[model samples]
Target: SVVTEMTGLGAHTLRGYERAGLLQPARTAGGMRLYSPRDVAIVRRAAALAAEGINVTGIRRILQLEAEVALIRAEFDGVPQPVVAASAERGASGTG
Candidate 1:
């Protein structure tokens, strides 16, 4: 598959990532996995992490934390200052 070629990961490894809930490539009507650019990037990152000796569970946690941080940063970017301030206060007060 293109992703396997691009990421230098074996097809079996890619399938393992999917089974481990790391990758979620879209599927065709015929059920062929379709790798988007983002999916490719994720595969590359996961491969790197695995090379660093991170286990699947560790990789999954790191990815989840990274995604949550990205979401928070995006929300902060678009939110008004007053709302941001209130949210910060709530967080500081342990109410958020």
Candidate 2:
């Protein structure tokens, strides 16, 4: 599958990802998995995070926060940019 090619993960690993709640691919009438672009991105990111020594639980937390940040950024994209940089700096400094 395209996802396997994109992420270097096998079919078994992909199914494990689905079971882990890291991927939400669509299903065909015959129960075939069809991965969307977002699923592909998540798989790639998960693989990268795993390669970087992050365990599955930590990767889940990071991915969840990243999605939340994207949503917040999109919501604020039309308005004048806020002072989120300071907030991000604080987060990086472990003071948030």
Candidate 3:
């Protein structure tokens, strides 16, 4: 697959990542796994983390946390800076 070729990971390793709940590639009607761009990015990141000696469990957690942070940032994207600063100040002062 292009993903395996691009990431330098084997099909077996990709299946292992799916089994480990680290990836959720889409499937075709015939049940072939389809790796989207996001899936490919995740595979690359997971391979890098593994090369850094992080286990699957740690990789999953880090990915989840990074996703959460991205979500939070997206949610804040359109808000005014003053509003964000005020909200932060209120939370800091325990008055939010």
Per-residue lDDT of model 3, residues 1-96, tens digit only? 788789999999999999999889989999999998988999999999999999999999999999999999998997999999999999999999
TM-score of every candidate relative to the true structure:
0.79, 0.77, 0.86
Query: What's the number of clashes in each of the models?
Result: 0, 0, 0
In model 1, the worst 10-residue window by lDDT is 1-10
Over 1-96, each residue of candidate 1 has an lDDT whose tens digit, in order, gives 777777788999999999999979899999999988988888888889999999999999999999999999998899999998998999999989
Note each model's CA RMSD in angstroms: 3.2, 5.3, 1.9
Comparing candidate 2 with candidate 3, which one achieves the higher lDDT?
3
Give the Cα error of residue 92 in candidate 3, in Å: 6.6
Ranking by lDDT: 3, 1, 2
Candidate 2 residue-wise lDDT, 3-64, digit = tens: 78888899988897788888789999999999888888898899899889998888889999
Pairs that collide, model 1: none
RMSD of 3: 1.9
Q: Which stretches of candidate 3 lie over 4 Å from their true place?
A: 88-96
The TM-score leader among the candidates is 3
lDDT of each: 0.91, 0.86, 0.94
The RMSD (Cα, Å) of candidate 1 is: 3.2
